[model samples]
Target chain A: MTADFDAIVVGSGMSGGWAAKELAERGLKTLVIERGRHIEHGTDYTDFKAPWELPNLDAVPEREQVHYGGRVIAASTAHFRIKEDDHPYSVAEGKPFRWFRGYHLGGRSLMWARQSYRMSEMDFEANKKDGHGNDWPIRYADLAPWYDHVERFAGISGQAEGLPQLPDGQFQPPMELNCVEEIFRDRLHETFPTRRLTIGRCAHLTAPTAEQQALGRGPCQSRSLCSRGCSYGAYFSSLSATLPAARKTGNLTIVTDEIGHSVVYDVATGKASGVRVVDAITREHRVYTGRIIFLCASAIGSAHIMLNSRSERFPTGIANSSDMLGRNLMDHVSGLGAGGYMPGYTDQYYKGRRPNGFYIPRFRNVTEDADFVRGYGFQGGASRGDWRRGGGQAGIGAALKQDLRKPGGWSVWLAGFGEMLPNPDNRVTLHPTKVDKWGIPLLHIDCAYGKNDLKMARQANRDAVEMLQAAGFQGVNERKAEPDEPGRAIHEMGTVGMGRDPGTSVLNGFNQAHDVPNLFVTDGACMASTACQNPSLTYMAISARAAHYAAEFLKEGKI
Target chain B: MSISRYSGFSRRQLLSGGARIAGGIAVGGGLAACADSAGQEASDGLAARLDTLTTRDALRRPGHFFSIAQFRLLERISDLIMPETDTPGALAAGVPQLIDRMMVTWALPETRSDWLAGLAAIDARARREHGVAFARLEPDTQFDVLSRHDGEALSASDRAYRQMKSTIVEAYYCSEPGATEELRYDPVPGPYRGCVPFDEIGRTWAT
Candidate 1:
């Protein structure tokens, strides 16, 4: 059958945006499908709105906030997030998961904390060495150039730290560490020779180049209101970067509010012919045929779509010949750290609201073998208390006013992101009877942290406390690690993971489904293992690499 | 200015202009530009002025959740926690109005009930000590009653008092005049000066 477009990229977010950009720039007519409302870049951003200008001082309505776990929702970017009631996913019995989702033109890219870091060679070899998950088909050497490609285009602001666990990337000048952070870094390095603390590598343009300036991006103004969306295009997001680049190619056609239902398979060709989509608002069904398809619809979202794509040739699911399609779900085991005050730096201060913090790269399994195989890294900042501290402090009237006018004592905190071993038991499946408002089957996520993850979390907490104490911090408060529920870190991965063998994984080296040559899943769903570093950057790099491969294969008529 | 009607053109222009000035400083002198950038001065002044104006306008809205008498009491309580000194206090910054609006729109029913109960407890204390409603009491008497409750609230798990006090503090600090003038509000500080003399910038950052 004749295809509607050359390529169809589902979910216009971090990965999908890159896929669309690469394909469209390669002169392929690309159709980008987003299952949410359209949101324009600069015009839609509310980052400039001050607290005084916000409705109810930037608090979400009670009923709405409660539905999303009663957490503090900043008023500036509340519009970007989805209310829990609107899109419901079930949790398996006794398993609690917090699925933070942002469904809009840019998906979670609009709301993602723009921490960008590359996974090291150690990460690629971890699963194989540890014998936990399937070994990745590709290695760091294969992805190095691709990481450089994405990093240069994205304008990552970070220092070139020579660390094997967390590789240095092509970066703009890194943001400066605050006084307390500098002190902690120096002292910690002296105290623990193995651990290294550097300023976090983030996707903010410290000094934008002419190319970035031409794209209407400017240097970050240090407002630290990035989640509200940067009007200056200082940070990397689909809206600020890839989608616009794709649009400029004139080969990109975006259809918002079009939910991808399933991938249509051709029995004769044994390739995915196209995708079936349901109108999010109109409930109308439409099938758009494409020569190639890329499922970048997030980890769980893509898994759900693939699991529901039952076919005559592959009755279980398309590209699920191994039955490993919706298994081995993983998120970074988090919520363990420590915080305390630093004294005697009252004379030193800092200017500018730094959007990024310091990153302590994983030292657990690097130099010395711990009880656990994998490791964790710490991400935190040091800052002085403002007037909000007055709430708990004892004072009122003139005295209280006088005290608050001056900055309070400086404090440092560290939160760990630990690697979770991929277990097939931690899986996602479609609910048999239940369906969403769009009539798509509901996703039932059943994932939990394993013994290794819990042990790592405990060590991370202890290390955090010890590090702070060793750095001459006082009144250290050790935060106990919480019971690991999946999806808290929002770095969910490993479903439909790429592996060397087709039997153990759904995708191969280039994020291509082993069963369907024309099909690609380049989002977090293609991760073979959950590396401690932020996964979005890896997702972008993989997506860009996969798109290039897919485009070349199309030219060679390989599929 | 009404947020819905705010064009945000002037602010954006001002910020971009400031950014250019900062950029010029960076080009003129590499690391030394951090010490003296006129761009920082321009942006800081503009942000402060805008914050003051916005906060002044926001404070004028009528209470939505609390009754007229209850709102009056809340205004007094808020002022006592953050009274006017060199800068605008909680009441002047429209913190009471923010709290009232939050109650109607954002606060849970239990939170709202706690606020009402806290107000009543204050009134009861005022009547017991000086035989008058909390709002009707003398300024010193009001302070004394609040001070006693503050101690009790800290020691005991006084949910009502804790809720009311925390809300007042949050609303005040988050307000424009309170955040900008009372503390240090730098909407755009350009490149972060990691370690600087505290004398250079005295107050804590109001992000």
Candidate 2:
């Protein structure tokens, strides 16, 4: 018996959106399933709720904070960090990973940092160049066309500087850096030849093209609150952009609150027969059959789905011939940098809100020689504290009230993203005894920092402090940098990685599973190497590439 | 005829319960307006004043958890924490309401009771220094009485007071008037003008 839909994509995040759009646009009856509730663009955001307007004024109770401190990684921290009551995850003690996240149709892509930069040939060629975990199946050249496709649609706003490291993409007008940032950028250019500082190329609408405007998107109103999910549809999100495009195809079917338990694989045909889903609310069971399946349920999420899918065909997990189902887990080592008060720029101020900041692309380990294996990039900005800061000062009464009417002092901070090499030891496994409210086994993650990661973390802090001090910023404090725990950066990657060799890797260059031809893993799980910059752009690129190839393969009857 | 005379109930309640129940009354009487446009000074000031009057007794009458003396002392201390300015003060943010909410939600029975006892002892110190109860003192006397308790870092009452002060300030600043007017709240920024001279624009943009 044939399936109802031509293909079924298990998530609606960055990868799932890409899969759905590509499949439907190619005239495939695609069903994009999301386990979370549907969130509409510009309306579902809690950011519109003012401070006093918050249910409990956004305060994380002391007891709750201590209890759920570890789970507040990239899980649901876009608005306020997720309270224990919201999206709760499990982790073994002595080995805790704060899986900060939220469950919605668009997923974390709605509240991503919006830093859009392409990973260069160096990044793709790194594992091959230095005998790392495994060679990336596809090179930069192979993935370049897909990147172009994603950018042309996503509408990245940035200046097209001919830098080998940060490739220029389809562009709109870039947001201007403030007076201090201009001075710093100008000064930094003169000081360092190889190091380039540019305005953050973000997935925000500097000016909406007809393509974006047709999607009911408007120009960037310059609200700095993109993290709370932009209500204006001025930013790129599955909710705001891609899903709508898929809906227009009239061939998309979406099912929310149905958690993908496993893909029913037939060993004789060596193909996925259908899939089972557990209802998030009622715990009811349902089966969905499709011609092909795409796993887009985040990095660890997709892996958990894969590991949980145990059939007699493959006991370890589906497509786990190499035993690489839940290994090589990676997330950027964040929380390493410096924040300081700028001495001057008191007279300088800007109008409107720029949701983006200045990006200092990878310098240390990229161009120049480094002690560590990989690289790190600095996402820094020059900004003065706003009126909201008036509450923190010791001042009260009229003087306090008057100052509140005005602005606060000038300040700048550099938060660096450092890349960590994948290790099998740092892995997430299913809990043997414990299960969640949904009866799914708890994800017991055991990840710790390596020597190389610790070194890179220190260097991230060191370079930031040194540069700020060089700019004559007094009272510049270097926050002690350490990769304290896993999942802090929220740039979760690896598990089902891309590799050239079949024995060493699960998926090939096309992100199609070696064990199962029709199955594709194109989310953060497919990342071969974790780069220093934000991973959304890379995810978009890989996803776009996989979806197109999968469509072609479907036509060819490659499975 | 007295309605429900056997049950000793009022006639108005009987009539209201019988019929004539009304629908479609204007909702959001004031809070909605405050949330919408905080820039409107008069409406915001009135809302804040109403907030204070409604919850003002939170500091007075003995808290469900606090002793009578302790409750009275806390009321005196909270007012001094945010003395009135040109605009409404911390108490105007309905901080006492926040305190009572916290007591029910976060605090335990014994810890709240111990703090209440400590508050009474602290008030005893204030009373020994002055003639009347702590809440009855003038603004100057209130400050003098509170200053001694401010930095008693070792004392649990002092810790509780600091937490109370922080919550009050946070509530005030984040209030419609405090955040929007005083702090100049801007959720979404307009346009990003990179590297403009101060003369170009006279004011700062809220992040």
Candidate 3:
């Protein structure tokens, strides 16, 4: 029987968009399903609004904020943020997971921090070397070309530093480091030769290519109001970049407001022949069939769907012969760093809000071995505090206004993003009883930081403080306050990880399920190890590479 | 005076011009004109862009939450706190009016009550200090009384006082005149000029 589409992608988000774009471009008729409301590219964005233009001082009302679990939602980007009341998921009693999600067409890509970095050879071999988690089926050599491919399409701006731990990528001209940042970089390098600071390698177009320009994307305007979705398409987002590219192929079909409930496993075929979806609004159920299925939903999201996909043949879930489908969840150990006031640079200031910051690559275990096996990197910037400083401080007259006029002293802060060792205990499972508005099972996220993760946090904080202090930064304070729980970094991954052995992991080297050849997971769910760098760029590369392999496999009639 | 709303710069201009428009603003220093152009656009236009969002009509209407007597005290206190310098002051920027409207629309009932109690305490203090209400006191006397109250409240870390003062400052600075005339207001800064001399870009960025 002929399927409805050649390939069915279960999401329209970060990796799903890439999957759809690559699959469609390679002459595959693809279906992209989104659970959120439809959002037009440029029209829906609020980037043009000034502070004065926004209502209620650009703050969500306390009454409405409570609906969002008391999370402060900026009025400008509030549309992108999901209301907790509408999309409720259960968290384990003691394990508080701040599952910050944006359930829109573009998903978190619209609000992503855009700091793009490639996972080096060290990151891939980390799991095997440490034996914390399952060894990755593929390594840096396998993904380097794909990273270059995606970086060319999605413009990454950065100054290439020849570091083994954090590999550089195909980059446009890097955003300049400010005077204070330059001083900090120079002093810190002089003090500690191993630790090097370079401008953040972000997926923002500093120089728009003919390909990007042809897609109506332009160069970065450095507005720094990117959380409110860029109308300029200066930043790489699914809505701005991939979805449009997929649409241009004319082989892609998108169905919004159709939430993926589960993958329908055909007992006879031993493959995921179709996806079962529940209508977000109508509460109606439907199934869309395809030759192959790509679960590009978020890590937890895809795992939730797979775990809910119970069948008689595979009682646990589809493609769960290994029973490793919903295990080994991970997120970056974050909220550790330091900040200090820079004494000089009173005569100098920076113009325009640079959306990017400088990155200090992982020095621990590479340049200097720490107590922990894995490592972390620092993402920070230097800037003078704006007039908002007057809100908390003393004085309220002309003197206060005058003091606030020229901006305050330049202060530098470094926030650490460390690799979280994947533990089977840190897993996502469906609640036995609870269900969401669409009658889909609620995701029970039971995740917490391990001993090594906490140790890394403390070490990261100490390293940050020492780096700042050694650079002659006055009033340097260690940022010891860790995140209340995991997922604060919003870098949740590794629910259905790739491994060399099928018994240990779900996906194989090509991100295809070992149990079900036609089923692929190229999102964060397929990540074997939680790399120190941001994972979106890796996800993009993986999705593109997986789609290429899947296409080749289809042509060979391997399935 | 009503807090003027800016518009007119289409999403098309923002998207199509991209870095070029931002580059022009960085080099030319015509951000004030760009910010003012937003105010020049029809206020109704904003309503069409965003769903269920209307610009705060603080100065366009009478006091929403505050009583007339209490409003007079707020107006006096806010002006004293952020008096007219080269830039517009709190009163001119409609800060008191904005606070009053926020009290009714934005603030929770507890917040409204706290602000009311804080306003009453200020009046009571004025009456105790000088045999008159705060609004009735002489300009210099009112300044002295408010200054003392400001110092005590700030040092004590009084939540209501801090919130009120912050609102006043925020409302004034976010105003078109305050943002454009008082501080630099760049809507679109093209390429980031990371290090520029303080004299080159004199005023602080009105973000």
Ranking under DockQ, best-scoring first? Answer: 3, 1, 2
Reference-based lDDT, residue B44, model 2: 26
Residues B150-206, model 3: lDDT tens digits: 889888989888888888788777866668777899989899999999999898998
lDDT of 3 by residue, A3-38 (tens): 999999988888999999999999999999999888
Superposition error at A497 for model 3 (Å): 0.7
Write the residue-wise lDDT of candidate 2 on B17-70 in tens digits.
231111111111222222222222332243233322222323222113222333
Tens digits of lDDT, candidate 1, A472-531: 999998777563577888999988889999988999999999999999999999999988
DockQ of the candidate models in sequence = 0.37, 0.26, 0.38
| i-RMSD values for every candidate model | 3.7, 4.7, 2.9
* Model 1 TM-score, 2 decimals: 0.91
lDDT of 3 at A63: 60
Question: Lowest lDDT 10-mer window, candidate 3 chain A?
Answer: A478-487
The CA lDDT of each predicted structure is 0.83, 0.71, 0.83
lDDT of 2 by residue, A170-256 (tens): 888888988888777776777676777888999988778788889988888876667777777888888888889998999899998
Q: Name the regions of candidate 3 deviating beyond 4 angstroms.
A: B1-63
